[model samples]
Target: MRYSYQIVVPAATYAPWLRDNEFLTLFKQVKKNSLVNFYQAYELWSLVEQLEKVNGDVLEVGVWRGSSSIVMGSKLKQLCSEKHVYACDTFEGVVKSDASRDNFYKGGEHRDTSQAFVAQLVEAAGLTNVTLLKGVFPEETGHCIESRQFSLCHIDVDTYISARQVMDWVWQRLSAGGVIIFNDFGFPMTQGITALVNEYRRDSDKMVIHNLNGNGILVKVKV
Candidate 1:
C-alpha cells in the first residue's frame, strides 16, 4: 500500500476587512447625501492600507473637493506620525484633454472646483497634516514639489497627457516599495493609461498589475 502525505496551510490575514467595513459604513451613510462617489471612497480605503505599511507621505493628483484626500489624510494621521499628505489640483472643473488623444474624459467635460471650497472641506475633515497645492498638474504645479517623496501616489487625472505627466513627475519620488494606482487603466476609453502601462511594463519587472473597479493599479517593488 502506498500513502500520500498532505500539507495544511494556515489561513491568510485579511488586511482589508476593517478598512472595507469602515468604507462600507461610510458609503451607506453618505451615498445619497454627498457629491463624493462610492468608487473613489473604496479606492481611498484601499490605498490607506498600503500607506500604513510604508509609513511615508501620501500624494494625490486631481483632488476634487478633498473627498478622497480627506479619507487618506485621516488614515495617515492614525497610521503614521511624521508623514504628510499633499493634494494637487486646479481647483476648477476638469481641464480639457488633448483633442488628438482618447481618454475617459475625451468628449466629456468636468466642472471647475474652487480652491477655497477644497480648503474648507479639508479643514472640516480635521486634517492638520494636509497641504493643498492649487494648480494644474505637471505644469506650474511640478515646481511646487521639488524634493518630496511619497509612499503612496494616486493618479486620477482622467486624461492621457495629464496621467502621463503625473506618472513622470512622481516616478522618481516614489519609494522603492511604493504603489501608484491609476484610476482609469481598464477603461478602454482611457487609452492614455493603457499606453502608459504598456510602456511602463517594458522597463519594469517589479510591477504588479491589478484590475479593480475599472481601475488599474501598478504596485512597485523595491530594487
Candidate 2:
C-alpha cells in the first residue's frame, strides 16, 4: 500500500486573499457555537483551500453541530468546485469509546444533533456540494462512498476506536498529495487521539506528519 502510491506535500501554500475575508465572515457566523477556536478553525479552512493541489473529494468524519462542515463546505464550493465534501457521522454523538484510553468521552456524549439540523446549516450556508451521511463511522456509512477517492479526510470523531477505523478506511482511497487531518491529537481531554496517531506513525513509514493548532496532519509521501 505504501509503495503503490505517492503523496505530494505542496510547499505550504496560502489561501487566496479574497477568501480570507470570506473565511473570517463565515467563521464568525459559526465560531460562537463551534467546538474549535479561531486558530483551529482557520487552519481547517486554510487547509481545505489548499486542496487545489490535488483532484479528489473531501471527507469530514465528525460533524458536531455542523460548524466545521459549514466552514469546509463553503470554502470547497469556491476552491474545489468539482470535489464534493462528505460529512460522515452518527449525528447522535459517538459510538462506544475505548474506556481505557478515552477518559472524558463516552458513547452518546455529543448527541445533540440530527441530520435535519445539519442539513439546515448546510442549506443556510448556500453550499450545494456537501453530503451529510448520518450513521456509525466506517461500518455503517463507509459503504456509502465505497468507490470514491479523497484529497483530504478530516478525522475528528474524538475516539481511539473511531479514529483508527477511519484511518484504515481512508488511507487507501486518499489520493496522491492528499492529507489526513486528525483533530484533537494534542488535546489533553482527547489523549486517545494522540495515541492513535502515534500508532499509525509507528506502523507507516511513508507519511509526513505535521502539527498545527491541536491537530495532527498525515501527508502521504508515497502512493
Candidate 3:
C-alpha cells in the first residue's frame, strides 16, 4: 500500500505584516547586529507575534548575541509592556554535542559571546523588560525561573540534551494556549534535536507540533 502525507501551511504564513517594511526594518536591524541570519531572525519576529494573544512571561533559551532576544523584547514592549522576556544563554557556546548524532557542532561551538555584551545590546535597544541569565540551563538559570509560568518559550540550543532539558522544564509550566518555538528543527546539522522533538511529539497528547521553515511550533491546547 502507498502512504500519503499532506503539508499544512497556516493562513498567517503569508500575512502582509511579515512582508511589510516595518518588519523588514526590524529584521535587517537585528541581522546586521546580531548573530542570526535573516531567516532565523524573521522566524523569531513571527513567533513573537504570538505573544499578543497569549498571557504570561516570555523565555528564550540559548540566546546567541541577543538577536532573537532583542526581537522578542522589542515586540513585547510594543504589545505587552508588562511582561518580561527572560534571555538565557551560556554565552559560552553550544554545550557538548552528541558526537554520534550531531554532525555540524561540537562542545562550545558558538561561544563567541558574553552576558555583558548581550546586556549592553538590550540596554542600548532601550529594552528595560529583559532579564539576562548567563549560564547552563536547568542548572544555573532554570532554577531561578522554575516557579514562573511562561506564555512563550523559544529554545534554540542545538543539542538533544539541552533541548530535552528545556522542554521538560517548560512544558508543564507553559500556560494554556502558550507557544513554544524550536529553532533548527528542520536543519540537517542538528538531527539530534530533530529526534528529540519528534520523540516528544509522539509522546505528547496535549501539545501539537507544527513545522515552519527551520522552526517547530508547539502550541498547548486548551483543556
Which runs of model 1 end up more than 4 angstroms from their true locations?
A: 1-21, 25-40, 103-108
Please report, in order, the local distance difference test score of every candidate based on alpha carbons: 0.69, 0.81, 0.78
Q: What tens digits encode model 3's per-residue C-alpha lDDT throughout 65-124?
A: 888898888877777568889989988999857877676788887888888988888998
The numbered model that scores best in lDDT is 2
* Poorest lDDT segment (10 consecutive residues) of candidate 1: 1-10
Task: Please say which candidate is ahead in TM-score: 2 or 3.
Answer: 2
Q: How does residue 222 of candidate 2 score in lDDT?
A: 71
Total clashes in model 2, counting residue pairs 3 or more apart in sequence or in different chains: 5
Residue 161, candidate 2: Cα error in Å is: 0.4
Summarize candidate 1's per-residue lDDT along 1-223 as a digit string, tens digits: 1122234344665445456675666456434323435665676666777566674688888786667677777676766567888888887656648756653465334444667877877786677988999878778677877688778887877787788788888877887788887776655556666666656775653585745454567776763
Q: Please give the lDDT score at residue 43 for candidate 1.
A: 69
Give the TM-score of each candidate: 0.78, 0.87, 0.86
Against the correct fold, how does model 3 do in TM-score? 0.86
